[model samples]
Target: MKNEINIIIITPELSKEGGGGIAIYTQILAKELSLDFEVERVVTLKERAVVNRVRVLFLSIVKVFYLLNRKKRKIAHIHTAHDSSFFRKSIFVRLCKIFKTPVILHLHSPSFALSFKKKSEKQQENIRKVFKLADKVIVLSKREKEWYLDNIEKRPPLVVYNGMNDLISSSDKVSERRNTVLFLGQLGHRKGTYDLIKAFKKVLENYSDAKLTLAGDGEVDECQKLVKSLQMDNSVEFLGWIGLEKKRELLNSSKIFVLPSHQEAFPLTILEAMSTRLPIISTFVGGIPEAIENNISGLLINAGDIEALSRNILKLLNNTLLCDKIGEFARERYLTHFKLTQTTENIKKIYTELL
Candidate 1:
């Protein structure tokens, strides 16, 4: 037990500054994997200043090579998304292969299929070279697995839902929640922040006491201008890039959580909302429907439909019984299916089998 085999998790960065979703997932997954294996995490990218970026990459390369040289049973569990992440990790994947270490390429990129379709033939050849070197490939959702099955010339990618520590708490249930809808993701058209803002502006018409708290940062100035232009400056508050403690506070106070993304493989924020027992109202895109059941765990609306988004928000805000019921079901589902315990167990099996 003390001398368990090592597993190296390669990612852009282990910290939050690298970006959300994958950064958060890699950190949480690495922490969980550490308990079962001698996990050593390496970052191929960093949130460094422009001048120091190349220096940082060089140091990381040196460190990774040193770690890979260690004489121990090891598996390179590379958590790769599409685009430059795959490019950056090519050397790591090659090194692990040269070392004869089992490689697990975990795909988190949402638009992998779309991206691959657009790639030039030569570019496609290079990408396929990386895929051929992997002992096994893992993806975040069934849709992603199917995407790889159609593209990659290998056995189907295994589906492994990204997991996190239980967000349930003793004082979890808020005795008196506010009439606020929370949107936690990057502020952009891709995440449907504009649609959320439009729907939220309408939400204020019926429930004037309602507040729409938009957390996370990206094009804040534009979103703020949109809110101001719509005369929703007073109702909408953009709390840019909050910490875990602050996130919990916001989740606790809010009645409903939404993520109207145009694209996503699986959203960690929804899982967090589910864990916090918030009635979710998100767009049915990518793997969201798999995590949320329409009128069951939470309500699901079509993407870009502000009318439906607004209707769903008002539906939950007005109906306390339904909100409580859906929130309860969401939390139960997280405990049963999306918890770290279940995900880590599956990861352990993949590691054990891949060897």
Candidate 2:
């Protein structure tokens, strides 16, 4: 069966090192599918330099053309975000259509609706045309699927929440975790990093010993400036762009995980925190509400609400029993819905249907 079906996963960069959620998603999907199918990964954008990236993209197009020309039962699984990522993957979708091969457009963008609304009418139509070309469209959340159904195209997209392997062990104990709050992802305005910093400052008014750790790359200088301005330099630590092992260590040691993003389709970091049995405090945006029940598995606050963010953080920190309960419930939800095996199986069913 592995030799009979060929699955081609298209992404900007396939490496786990310094890759965003989309890259990580592609890597996991490709690895799992390879166990049962002949998997090929086509990296369309790898180089950091603009000229090199453009050259690589062109080469990827040629490579896709050549691969589809071969005699095989193949499916092109293209992972894309908004704006340039969408346009780049649309080329592959068109090429797959030309070869009469099934293509799946897997969207991982949180602000895709906003991006689409910013485009001109003709450009919006072009975007719709590209979406229509694909044999199937997969979204990260049901909310996203509905948005596409009402705005992008009438065909409803399949929802596939991002999943992760469980990261907690029996030896891991809540008593051993520190009073540390962890935020993992790009450090920019969209992610509400500055808001989190301000909220953390407020949190320090009560629990002065509480620490905030910001990991991942983006606007580090700006975020540092904000931290300094808020007099949180001593309390807030920024570790730019960490690897998987470091992320796991942070998840295990941190008492809480918070991501107050202005927008998100579905964040894999939330699932990672859940898998590690860490109480989460995130915004009520995108598919987050689907994953977290308010005051149950985790706490949810509106985006950019610094006061609410601070209050929620304190609510969990002030009560250890409540924090442990939320963390345990989060882990339960992860095991029931967002485990890596379950996600891979759902994706495999889509592939089978398309085939």
Best by TM-score: 2
Would you give me the overall lDDT of model 1?
Answer: 0.84
Model 1: residue 321 alpha-carbon error in angstroms: 0.5
Which segments of candidate 2 are over 4 A away from where they belong? 1-3, 14-16
Query: Per-residue lDDT of 203-316 in model 1, one digit per residue for the tens?
Result: 898999999999988879999999999999889999988888788888878889999989888999999889888899987888888899889998988889999999999988
| All models, RMSD in angstroms | 1.7, 1.5
Candidate 2 C-alpha lDDT tens digits along 203-292: 999999999999988899999998988888899999988888888889999989999999888989999999988999998899999999
Lowest lDDT sum, 10 consecutive residues, model 2, at 167-176
**lDDT for position 192 in model 2:** 90
- Could you tell me how far off, in angstroms, the CA of residue 171 lies in candidate 2 after the best superposition? 4.2
Q: How close is candidate 1 to the true structure, as a TM-score?
A: 0.95
